[model samples]
Target: MSELLQLIKQAAMEQVESSKPVAVMIGKVVSAAPLEIQLDQKLRLTEEFLVLTKAVVDYSINMTVDHTTESHTHSHSYQDDSTSRTTQPHTHNHAYVGTKSFTIHNKLKVDDHVILLRVQGGQEYIVLDVVGGGIL
Candidate 1:
């Protein structure tokens, strides 16, 4: 009976160890290309082991814009000669219209501290965002 009880306790302990209890952890980026993170002094996770969120990945957004602007200008001039004197005043108004395209880039760099969420079964970690050194 004692032997059976010991076996049941051992099984429960094995199950608990296999299923990691810690769901969230902090990590520091050690590499950018072929990304890698250091979870602890002895545990380093490679790129394949991580799933990156937009906040931690390098990405770009393309945008197009069309708008118009109005402006006004005024000028005054005075001239005098031996026989004549005159003054001229001028005013002008104009509008500027155009269309443009641009891109916004977002990226992450090395040495950034990030938040990580461990996927169920503990096989992968989702990089939520960079918490330190700012997201690039």
Candidate 2:
């Protein structure tokens, strides 16, 4: 019985050693090349790909101020335009300053900026980390 157990353990160890080593791919993830190129196939960029970029955007808010009143002639009420005060209803544009980062769901180029991936098996790879490509 002890010998059989030992044999089983050895077989398990040999199976583990025979398997392919897990590959660690650290670089940009580009799509599979064409037949002419004959490069490894990878994840391709699409029209709805996510990317980061820096941009300056301005925000404005519209506000309404009510400044209308109806005046009626009354003996008790004061009758003078100077005594009554009202503010003009107007809107002023406000400008926002500073640069901000925006997430864009657009197409990406062939080359990648930076990425970390793990090859599960064959041509399959899982993206671990990625950074935006282009000017920041």
Cα-based lDDT for every prediction = 0.75, 0.40
**lDDT minimum window of 10 residues, candidate 2:** 31-40
Clashing residue pairs for model 1? none
List candidate 1 stretches off by more than 4 Å.
Answer: 1-14, 17-22, 68-104, 132-136
RMSD, each candidate, Å?
9.5, 15.9
Candidate 2, 52-111: lDDT as tens digits: 222211234344444434443333334376685444444444344344454443333345
The candidate that wins on lDDT is 1
Q: Pull out the clashing pairs in model 2.
A: none
lDDT of 1 by residue, 8-123 (tens): 99999778766866589888888888789999999999988999888776565555544444444555545556445444545555554454444334455678888999886677
lDDT of 2 at 48: 32
Error of 1 at 126 (Å): 0.3
Task: Provide the global lDDT of candidate 2 against the true structure.
Answer: 0.40
